[model samples]
Target: MNTNTNTNAIAAARQAHSTRCRQRVLTALEQAAHSGDEITVSAIARRARVDRSFLYRHRDLHAAVLVKAAEPATASTGGPSASRPSLIADLANAHDRITRLSHENTQLRQRLSEHLGEQAWRESGLCPPDDIDRLQRRVTELEQHTAEQRRQLAERDDELDATRATNRELMTRLNRPHPDGA
Candidate 1:
């Protein structure tokens, strides 16, 4: 029996690929419950491309995605109307637009810590202010322009040491032997 007909043709090709992955995860949970959408086991394993651990090992597609994620959202012109906005007035207008954008981000971070002064607001550790009087008047105008460039480089090194002591006394009076011994 050719190995019992090749083990019943590899168990009928793994039961026709587990009946085409359980009919594409029950037609992607009936097209995410006819489009109100959010059903979930990772949105029916990304609309049945499959494996969220095969929709958590299929306990009836994980109890039909927890009974279509506890059902309640009907409205497509089917009933509830008094001019729409209910889910607790859309969660109290999203908590009053997140408390008016968290008090306009604390008044634009207290006007950028009073326009970034105090040594650029303590080197940006945010807010602390003794106001570095304009960085101590730009470090007292760069220490009086570095003490007037060190008094003009000590008067050009005392005029290059008096022109190198008058060129070493005119090369010691032309090498001394000009005493009429021309």
Candidate 2:
């Protein structure tokens, strides 16, 4: 009976219309999925006459809707078979994609294993390979350093021996040659 209540009802109807517009956009997306053809979001927004960002922000919901929509329709013949070639084609395509991605995943895992092996080598600081090499470069360097130190030690021992021998010769000469002076 009041014009004020009529205005509020009109506003409520407009809001409901906007909500339905957004829902219709989602419906269009669900219908287009599994064809392997690109579904342009802009086209959806244009068809719904709604803002595109709202659809983008709720993309997970959109994806869920598409998945639900793509579910196999009930087989009137009580089994899934040659009766539904279109559905079968879509399922076959999905199967192929799953297999291909699985193969790629294995290859990636192998490469990651190789990368980890290289990292372990770098971290351990072990002599780089060639345990049976002709010249064993790292071991050769260690052996050369050891030989140099041994040579120096032998020379020092020789000098000590020569000092002892001279001391003994001087003592013999002193004891024997003093008879002439007496």
Candidate 3:
């Protein structure tokens, strides 16, 4: 009978300890939520001064933590509430800003690289000579060739016209009656 009484006392003490731990966990959860702090399982466990395994062992407590964690933190401190949509919009804006900055950075880098390359080339004394005079001479030669081709085409046109006129005259004379009939 004495051994059974001792067992009951042990069970009672364990039940009391469990009740205290559960209360502590609930209080910690409320505090964390009110303060707009993160409600992760690890954070709750630490805040409650309870082992992670303890929360896991109590399925109700674990589910409560999960539910609270899924909820967006309410700003009881007069700050902005971090809603899911607002956070996502903020992230998208940040990503767009980063993309724009990256593109600008690439353009600036390319310009700098081009400027440096030109400077280096000039310093190396290997710059190619200007070909303005050569280009001008070539242009003049092509213009003269083009003029000659046009002149030849005009001459051919005049010759063709004259040949057509002569053929018409010959045909007119042949069609006319001869002075003496054959």
- Ordered from best to worst lDDT, the candidate numbers read 3, 1, 2
- Over 1-182, each residue of candidate 1 has an lDDT whose tens digit, in order, gives 99999999999998898789889989888777766666768878888887888777768878888886666545466875332235558888999999999999999998888876666757888764456688888899999999999999999999989988998999988889987899
Number of the top-ranking candidate, with lDDT as the measure: 3
Candidate 2: clashing residue pairs, number: 0
Task: For residue 29, give model 3's deviation from the true position in Å.
Answer: 0.5
lDDT score for candidate 2 against the true structure: 0.70
Per-model C-alpha lDDT, please?
Answer: 0.80, 0.70, 0.92
Question: Quick one: best TM-score, which candidate?
Answer: 3
* Candidate 2 lDDT over residue span 1-182, tens digit each: 68989999999998798678767876766554433233456655665667777667677645654454455444345665332346668899999999999999999999999999988886898736545475577689889999999999999999999999999999988788575587
Estimated TM-score per prediction?
0.30, 0.27, 0.59
| TM-score pick, better of 1 and 2 | 1
lDDT for residue 127 in candidate 3, whole number 0-100: 69
- Model 1 misplaced stretches (Cα beyond 4 Å): 1-96, 103-135, 169-171, 179-182
Alpha carbon deviation, residue 75, candidate 2 (Å):
19
Task: Assess candidate 1 and give its lDDT.
Answer: 0.80
lDDT of 3 by residue, 1-182 (tens): 99999999999999999999999999999998888787888999999999999999999999999888778888867776785556779999999999999999999999999999988887898966568589889999999999999999999999999999999999999999999985
| CA error at residue 100 for candidate 1, angstroms | 6.4
Residue 176 in candidate 2 has what lDDT? Answer: 87
